[model samples]
Target: TSQHFDTCLGCLACVTTCPSGVQYDKLISATRHQVTRNQERTFSDNVIRTLIFNLFPYPHRLRPLLVPLFIYQKLGLPKLVRKTGLLKKVFPRLAAMESILPKVTVDSFRDNLPEVIPAQGEKRYRVGVILGCVQRLLFSPVNEATVRVLTANGCEVVIPKSQGCCAALPEHQGQAEQAKALARQMIDSFENTGVDFVIINAAGCGHTLKEYGHILADDPDYREKAEKFAANVKDVQEFLASAGITAKLNPLIEGDLTIVYQDACHLLHGQKISLQPRQLLQQIPGVKLKEPVDAALCCGSAGVYNMLQPEIADELGVQKVENLLNTGAELIASSNPGCSLQIKKHLELQGKTVTLMHPIELLDYSIRGVKLLRK
Candidate 1:
């Protein structure tokens, strides 16, 4: 634990205020003891302390690991696991994480795709839409909204034929080598396509792809190539806003709908985008925009943390959902897919009708004649 505990403690002053079982001062003393060679590093100490989880854990078994995860959600195992308490022994923090457990939705974004859309038309700009693995498999509707809005705004959409994981999943899990390989492949595939920009619906992948230059800075052939590719990656929301696509004047629903906007970690922290979506959404005729109390904090659905570090993720997700209640927004708006599911589930568990949706869907609704979102 000392391997990273010291650095973690240094970064997070909250460790000093931690009232958890692991006394903060004791952890600090343990770190000192380990550094003084008084204790041998155990396997957990080595793996947990050092942030190299993705590298070895995923290893050559990425697809298998990810597939089971997808299938588990599909089978509603997360909810069952929460209900059964079977994992409480193995994972003592299971109950602490239950509130934030983003249960499986009725339809994952993947099942709703067009699988194949028409080719590039004679539009002013033709861009390659990077439908990331997570976005494609879980948050597919975001992509649909993105495509609908983009196509309606006079741009051609092309899902790269040779795209795979952008290396975000592996990179986050500490599999640097695998992630780098995927990033290189992504660059090669997109460069050959001759598109104006790479549109990304998921903020996480957008941030990761934007790091292609840094991730490949050591490679000779890929350094400049990666740099060039990373420069073109655009978050779907930012891209639309930059293009001056005004939300269409449509007759919105007559009933009441209060919406709160959650600034996803990547969209705010990584991309540093603040005004685009907010300003765009404000253009809507009859929509009340609500802001969270803790305006700047991670929702804990940071990548696969909801499944891996369930407790901590759940704690953060529920706290986020509670913060949303302060604004009384009936719906949660997020740019990231992971945050959407995480917030959506917490709200559902509370017996509240607060739903998770993308800002683009709202923007699309305003732009299009009718609400594209299905009930």
Candidate 2:
């Protein structure tokens, strides 16, 4: 029983496939919580888990570590180290992790975004955006793009300074108390803003946010509040599609780019949001939307799955990358950061040059009439 649970990606793909309408998400979450509380682990496992939980959930803690990583990348140490096979010989797991590490920029979105970004035109909706933990540190551009696209479409984007992690990390890892605490903090921070909707760009964060009601169902004080909070939670794509685009979209100045939309498991399986993102992508001029084979299958990023289960994660990522490459697209658009990182690393390993980006980023490019640059 625990064996299956241990290997489970928590991608919620089975939930969508099941005909009985079983709540596997809730079941798996509960089991994970029990494991965290009762299960024992090796010293190495504990150290790794501690390092990840302590650092990744806190931007301040994670930022300082990036400085050395940035320097390493800038000095071309990554290539040199790979060539020497030093990491593979001394620390195989670290090598696997280092291979997938995304390029970190000096300026993070936290340093750039103002408290309030006014609407570009007449304000139709006042929206609050959640800058997730890992998203803030690793994929700040996605949050920045989300705000740009939202404001361009006549939405007043309110990014509360008080908002912290959405507790997706802890909840997914089975730290129930920590997850609840963070959830409450987020609720207190965002609910007071009185925004029409709380928008999230990362699919994993959105899924966890929308399940706050279930996470806090046992809390008498927060049960109603959590439910109300969850009700307003919307993926950026979902919100944009429902609200309709008010801004004019310009075609890519460069030639038409064929994009393969890789459905983030959280978006497709967890939230059952499959079409809205693709619809938004198709709306962009000079953009050709193509679907990869097994579009519904997980890219194996399932939160921290890539880090914890690298071998299995890499296998699934390779398969996903193969499907994506077969589509003959110039770029891969995914809503989740983890999926982006996983897919990106595998593509690079396979000597592929396809760009990985969030759907909103493409929309932002089209809206601003800018050329999409590959990394």
Candidate 3:
């Protein structure tokens, strides 16, 4: 039963496909939490869980490792290890960790965005952007692009420096107490920002943010506040789609660019936001969106599932990459960091390369009148 539950991807595709409107996501979450409390995990499982819980949710903790990671990748050590097959043979979980290591950049080491970013032209809304834990550190460019796009669309973006993890990782994995604590801290951080909406670029974090109400419903102190916070939370794409595009979108490339928008499971199934991202992308001049086969299937990056269940995640990742590539798109647009990393790793493994970027990043380039170099 534990194995059966562990293997479930928690993609919530069942929820969407169900005719009876079953809340399978909630059921799975509750079951995972119960398993954590009652079941005894193996020694290896405990170690992996401890490592993930301690490091992934804290930017400060993750930042220190980037320098070493950068050096490791720069030296081509990751490739060497893959060729040797030593790590995967010995410690598969650690091998999984190494597999999705993104190429670290200078932006990975800094938090350069200002606390208050003034809107271009007339401001239509004042919003707070949540710079998620892995997002702020690993995919800082996404956060940067998100801010630029939001500001270009006439939003005064406020990023509270005090904001930390949204606890999506813990929350998804059923570390209930830790998740609750982080959710409380998240609420406290943004409570005084006075922004009309709290925006999240990463789908996982956005889904978790939108569930603050349910997550904290039992807390007497935070029940009402969490509900209010959850009410105002919006995925960046969702907000932009609803608000409508005010900024002019220039052609990203000289000719029509065929791009595939990979739907992160959390955004599509968890938040019920399938059309908004496609609508926003189609607004860009000379941009064409392509649909992949099994577009709604999980990429198997259900939060940290890729790290914990590497073999199964890898199979799903390969299928997802194939589907995306079958679209013959020049670029792939993804909204979630975990999905991006998971797909990227599999793409690399297959000795194939495609330009994968956050939808917001592509939008940022279009709004800024920058053209992507393409063959």
Candidate 4:
């Protein structure tokens, strides 16, 4: 039973496919919770799980480790190590983990952004944004781009300092109490903002944020507040589409760049959002949107699935990468950081030069009339 639950990626793709309206998401979560309580694990498995849970959810702890990693990258050690296969020989799992680390900027966007960024022109709507746990450390630029795009299009963005993890990790792993504690903290952080919408750039976090009501259904104190909170939760793409773009976008150079839009499982299946992100991408002039062969398939970055089940995750990543490469696209746009990282690792392993970006990043680049940076 534990092995069966472990194999489940928690992508919620089955939820969309089931004709019987089965609540597979809830079932999986409950099963995983039972596994957590009842099952015993090998020492190595216990260590890996403990390390991941302890590290990924805390940006402060993660930041210290990035210093050495940043130095390693700066010194070109990553390339040398990969070339020599030293990591593969000594630490295979760590090698796989290192392959997905994005280029670390000297200063994270979180350090620069203020609590509130006022709209550029006329203020159309006031909104709150979630700066997620791993997202804040690894993909801070996405949040920065989201804020810039929102403000450029006449939305006042407020980022509460009190905000913490969306609890998607714990919730997906069946750590119900930890997930609920985090959810309660987040609700307390954003509830007083009086914003029209709560924006999230990470698809998994967005999906989890929207389900806070269900997660906290049994809490008498939080039940009503959680429902209200969930109602306002919106993926950045969903909010931007509904609010409409007020900024004028410039076309890419030469008026041509093929872009493959990879749908994050949470965004498409969990949240039932498919068209809005594509609509936003199409709005940019000179950008051609192409769908992968298996558009409905998962890229295998279902939360921590890549870290836990690296072999299976790599297989899915390779398959997804092949589909994207076959499109002959110059760029890949995805909303989730996990998908972006997973795709990027596979692209690198395959010796591909295509750039991977968040949908908002592309929109920001177009609006600012800048070129998309490639890896």
The numbered model that scores best in lDDT is 3
State candidate 1's TM-score: 0.76
- Provide the lowest-lDDT 10-residue window in model 4: 104-113
What is the Å distance of residue 34 in model 2 from its true position?
1.0
lDDT against the true structure, per candidate, is 0.66, 0.87, 0.92, 0.88
lDDT of 2 by residue, 307-359 (tens): 77777888999999999999999888988988998999888889988878898
lDDT string for model 1 (37-73, tens) is: 5445665445443433343223233334445556777
Model 3 alpha-carbon drift over 4 Å, by segment: none
The residue pairs that clash in candidate 1, if any, are: 53-173, 54-173, 54-174, 54-175, 55-174, 55-175, 109-138, 109-140, 248-367
> After best superposition, candidate 4 residue 119: deviation in angstroms?
1.0
Model 4 misplaced stretches (Cα beyond 4 Å): 84-86, 89-91, 373-375
Once all C-alphas are superposed, what RMSD does model 2 give against the true structure?
A: 1.6
Summing lDDT over every window of 10 consecutive residues in candidate 2, give the lowest-scoring window: 104-113
Candidate 4: lDDT of 38? 94
Give me the runs in candidate 1 sitting further than 4 Å from their true place: 1-80, 91-122, 246-251, 371-375
Comparing 1 and 4 by TM-score, which wins? 4
What lDDT tens digits, residue by residue, belong to model 3 across residues 138-191?
899889999999999899999998899998988888899999999999999999
TM-score, candidate 4, is: 0.96
Query: How well does model 2 score by local distance difference test?
Result: 0.87
Indicate whether candidate 3 or candidate 4 has the larger lDDT.
Answer: 3
